[model samples]
Target: MQRALLIAAVCVAAVALWLWGFGGAEHVTVWAAEGQRAAQNAMARGLRSLRAGDPGALTALLGLCFAYGVSHAAGPGHGKILIGGYGLAARVPLTRLCTLAVASSLAQAASAVALVYTGVLLLNWSRSYMQSLADSLMAPLSYGAIGLIGVWLVLRGLRKLAARNGDDGHGHDHNCNHAHGPTAQQAGAVRSLRDAFVLVGAVALRPCTGALFLLIITWRMGLAWQGIAGAVAMGLGTASVTLVVAAASVTLREGTLARIAAGPATTRALGLVEALAGATIAALALQLLLRAL
Candidate 1:
């Protein structure tokens, strides 16, 4: 009874934390907005210094870009949403999830680079047009992809629950044949890898506006290489925050699971957690998509 009560309390705490993070409490939202504006202003100044051929300007600009990334990521964003949700919903290894966070951040940066260069060099598209494309088309597509991920998680959880319901008391399926095939662990690893790719893709589809701005300004100033480097540095900075979120979510999830007694109850709890997390993610994605559209 005590264990159950403890588990309930932990679950409640987790949900509260999630809500506080995602729901954008007025104070937090105001602080984040202010920080972002300040960081963006500093970045613009750094770009001007670089353009003036000032010594050490490159270093300062890169530093500002990194800071901008950190400030931007501190706000409620899709990357955090996806990473935190997946961490809670799935039994992904901590190292793997952290890797995914970094990969997704870097991929997002790369997408910005690709989009800017492609538009400016090949298509002769203006900055406003490119930004509009990203905001209008890519944003919706990314949200849709995230929604699909949520649906995938929901279905996976439901299937696991169904399988558990069909399990005999011996912890093995009674209808199973002893046929040679890839082990369940191997299959799971494959699926996890695929999911990681999808997560990265979803994030990459929506390039960071800051990155796009940096790239365009640097490109106009004939510092394309520096822009690339700054974009990468910014990605690292963003990854730092997402990594923290990933770690926290995993720790919370594992801590909760540890509190549960090892039995069918634990299995059911895992399924329920996954389903609930997935449902929340899907709902959030739907809301974002609607707003974007």
Candidate 2:
């Protein structure tokens, strides 16, 4: 009964979060209602010009969306959404979770750029066949990336679950637990580099629908290049905010005492946190991919 209640709670929380953060994506009217008047006016102007085949109008819209998309997607709030599970882990410092958030946000921005640029290139290469090709290429790439990342998250969750089984059940292993930041020299080493690379890669493995949406809208508007430009801008904006939050979280985690608490009870608590966070992340990742496809 407890397990069932927990599952239900998690599901409820997930749904609420998704709706609060991402509901605009599903309901076009929501965007129309929330967009700044200035932005809406600008978009209206740009659309008119584009419809009339004005090159300048096309250029402006492309630039606007790309910038907006990148900034919005990489923003710190979005990072919170992506790594909230990690932050909830008992054994993990909120700061460490924040770093993961920052890493993921950056990865997401980079991936958005890649996706946008690919769309631009395909449109240019295909000329008259731009629309069909863009949908075909972009959808599969985005959904496939999401699925692959979902699988990885599930595997990671399983590993965490297995590790928990090996614990001595004494609570937090206080004697062995030390939350020391690596020395600068140690951070410069090859192992550190590998870890950094893995973090960045793992964070970016999931595809963002925001980038895909921009690409599609831009293509349909007949502003392929401008669409890509908008994507890049959006990515940068998003990354800036998320990275800062992550960095702040890291700084706090490095100094926190709550991370070092001991006993089997503590250990079990931490293990449960890890398991729940991992499972939540894995489930959401899969759901995103499935919905996208």
Best-matching candidate per lDDT: 1
Question: So what's the TM-score on candidate 1?
Answer: 0.86
Model 2: C-alpha RMSD to truth? 9.0
Per-residue lDDT of 196 in model 1? 77
Please provide TM-scores, in order, for all candidate models, with all chains considered together: 0.86, 0.50
Global lDDT scores for all candidate models: 0.82, 0.49
Shift in Å, residue 66, candidate 2: 8.2
Candidate 2 lDDT tens digits, 175-275: 77653232223322332344345545655644344555555566767766665565555555555555554443333322231343444334444445545
Q: Model 2: residues >4 Å from true position, as ranges? A: 1-67, 70-81, 86-123, 126-230, 240-260
Model 1, 1-293: lDDT tens per residue? 55654565577567657657666455555776787788788888887888788999989888877887887788767888899889888877789889999999999999999999999999999999999999999999999999888988888778767766656345666467852222323322534467778999999999998899889988998989999999998898889889988887777777777677665666666777888889878888888899999
